[model samples]
Target chain A: MITRTLFAGFGGQGVLLMGYVLSHGAMHKGLNVTYFPAYGAEMRGGTANCTVTLSEEKIASPVASNPDILVAMNFPSLLKFEPTVVKQGLVVLNSSLIEESPSRTDIDLLQVPTVELAREVGSERAGNMGHGGSSQGQGKVLRTQP
Target chain B: MPSEKMLMRGSNVVGEAAVRAGCRYYFGYPITPQNELPEYLSARMLDVGGTFIQGESEVASINMVLGASAAGGRVMTSSSSPGISLKQEGISYMAGMELPAVIINMMRGGPGLGNISASAADYYQATRGGGHGDYRTPVLAPAGCQELAELTFVAFDMADKYRSPVMLLGDGLMGQVMEPVIFPDFIDLKDLPKKDWILNGCEGREPRAIFSMLLGQGELYHHNLDLQKKYDQITAEEQRWETKNTDDADIIVVAYGTAARIAESAMNDLRAEGLAIGLFRPITLWPFPSTAFRELAQNGRKVAVFELCLGQMVEDVVLSVGERAEIYFYGVPGGVIPTPAEVADFLRSVAKGDGEVGRRIDV
Candidate 1:
């Protein structure tokens, strides 16, 4: 089985770190994994993202135009990648930051109050983990949090 | 005895390996994805009685390395894509003077004004002699943190042995990735072969001038020819590669550095699918392991070259095969890297003789 996920948000939102953690977990599970980040100016306050592919076999291109899971931590991320989610794919959005939800009928959209869940966890930066776990519950997306 | 293992970034691994190899001087400017190298060296060099300088610019850094090497000390400098471009002139001069120094390039995207993204776009410039003049620098490509450490030591050894500049070519991902690295046992610098050509004030000996300039055309031509001879010797002796499951394989995938690591994963996937696919990873980018590739191609196997840049190393692969076998290219440009699955897919098609041409995957 092959699972690909893209996490996108503002630079300091820990989107890249989320991807790193996910990739590391996948590798630890004995899956072949590749993680690539949007570097350069895109990392400086702009929309930053990372693409990770975890597979039982081998992963081909690390670039995923249509990801199996799209974790959007901000409004721009949701708007930019919402259209590229695979059919029946899961889209996890941070409800606190994204006022409008993706209305794509082909994909399952989960609107999670990620910031609130993170605050409940005693760490505001755990928003990505909150969204990641919530989306994993919806299906197909692997449980990435260790 | 086994070496000690340490959790290190690929860049710092290179720096540490250089120190272990008896490098006494380091000069570099800070660059993203590789800044940790000079930063780590700043402290480590002090322990070894070496010197580390954060230069004003990349040009100054390379020149400083050249000066230190000229003074009979093993020296090194490092930079990323744009910074490397600025140091090309000094590199050419170093090569001309036959100075022994190691230069590390944590490559990023580029033609002009490219950013801090991992890309092998500098392949042509690095392997084909980016610096001017009829000269060449031995380029070593390391796929992972382990190779990053080992190859750094090799780079220093090769520089001193050949009395020429050596380049350690890595990318942004390689620079930043954390891995367990085994540090080599310390070798006594005094035990290494002496460098008589270095200018050490020439006290009581005939004055030795170290310069690339030759006034006469014949002398210049002779110098270039001598350099070519050395390159030819290196090509014959120093080509390094790793071959996985090539025997009875139908498709041989050629890749180097980080791309080779992805290819290894992809090769495993193709093998599980009952397809005959093997991986050929070049550890020495310049010498290129052409002999092994030529032998593989002559065995009537199809070749597929994968790279992060458009058809750079593929051209060399084709030349190595010498039209004895059909070759294909799969490239991902603009700071993109193909996943192992994608590479497996390409390999499967090639093995089946599906005849699918090159394609790009946007992430």
Candidate 2:
């Protein structure tokens, strides 16, 4: 029962923190987890992305071939990773920034207005965290966390 | 040193493990993926009352390691592929001078500044003694964070025990991955064994001069002979490997570091379908774990060596297995990470009643 996820956005969007939150939360709950920060592959304006894999058993590969979930905090991130999400997988996109819908219809899509939500909450930079919670509900992965 | 279970980044785990292992001096230059190691040490070293220096360059950093180790300090330095390439001369010097220091190479892309992705392309450079010398650096290739933590301690111990340079080898994936790990109790520095060969604290005895230069006739040859004897002893006793179900298996997969992780995943996927396959992982890349590896090939099992480089370690695998079994090779070069599905595809092909496995197949 391995749940592999990729969280992506520009450098300062706290995208990596989103992955860390999920990874740490899963690990704290006694699940095996591996969070891989990929610093080189960002083609759109040199952003950093990370891949997080959490499993009930030991995880073999930290580099996910096809992610079960992709939390895209920006337009380019969505554009870049939307094609790589596995079929019938989940994609939590920030509707605040990614205006276009996903091209593939096989996977599940959940859109949240994270930018406006972060602005409303008075912390404009916390937009990534707003949508990051959407994927935490996946596989009941973070249900036990406070 | 807390004994509680903790989730930490792979790089940070190494830093804390080094500190817990009684390492008091660290010198390293920043490189992509491995930067977190020095970053963690920068703050943690201060807390541990240790010394951390962001060396001006990779060469400068390894030389600093050489100096500190000569002074009998538990010291370490880390770098990525290109950075490690630059440190070879100093590493060679350390080897010839018989200094104990731990060096971590969080391997990234290739020949030149390829990319910041995981790769085991430095296998030949590491296992064959990257620097020019009649010396072999003990190499520990950790597959995950837990092993990463444990092996850091082993690397330090091996370095000091052998009075030679030691390398902790892993790819960028090992560096960036954050995983849960419970480490052992911290090693009290005072309990560590004393070294009389160091260049410092010789007030009551003759002032010690430590160097690799043996200009006298037969001096370098005798030094090389003694170093060879030490390496031979290491080869006999320090070959470390792990085998999964090789006792009753027809096919064995050989790999190390990050590549072994992928190979295990692929092997497991095949095992679910009930394939008679096993995995042979070498923890000690140098010393190469040849004896244990040779034992696994006794029953005419088909051996496959998988690596992230273009068939470097496969040569060592061939030498280990020899004509005892049918040996095959699978390689992924240039920092491209191979998925388990792809690796499984290859393994599946080999396992499906094939009359003979191909020799040196590079994919």
lDDT of 2 at B246: 84
Off-target runs (Cα >4 Å) in candidate 2 are A41-45, A144-146, B353-363
In lDDT terms, which candidate is top?
A: 2
lDDT (Cα, 0-100) at A99 in candidate 1 = 93
DockQ of each: 0.17, 0.62
Q: lDDT tens digits, residues A1-146, model 2?
A: 78888999888788888888888778778899988888765545668789989889988878777899988888898899998889999999888878999999999988889879889999988777777877776555667445
lDDT of 2 by residue, B251-349 (tens): 999989888888888888789999888999999989898888888887778888888887888888878777888777777888888888777777876
Best by TM-score: 2
Which residue runs of candidate 1 sit more than 4 Å off their true CA positions? A1-7, A18-36, A42-44, A51-72, A75-95, A98-112, A121-146, B1-7, B31-33, B43-49, B186-193, B204-206, B216-218, B341-345, B348-355, B359-363
Residue-level lDDT of model 1, residues B91-150, one tens digit each, is: 999999999899999988777766677889888888888989888889999987777988
Question: How much lDDT does each candidate structure score?
Answer: 0.82, 0.87
Model 1 chain A: ten consecutive residues of lowest lDDT: A137-146
lDDT of residue B193 for candidate 2: 75
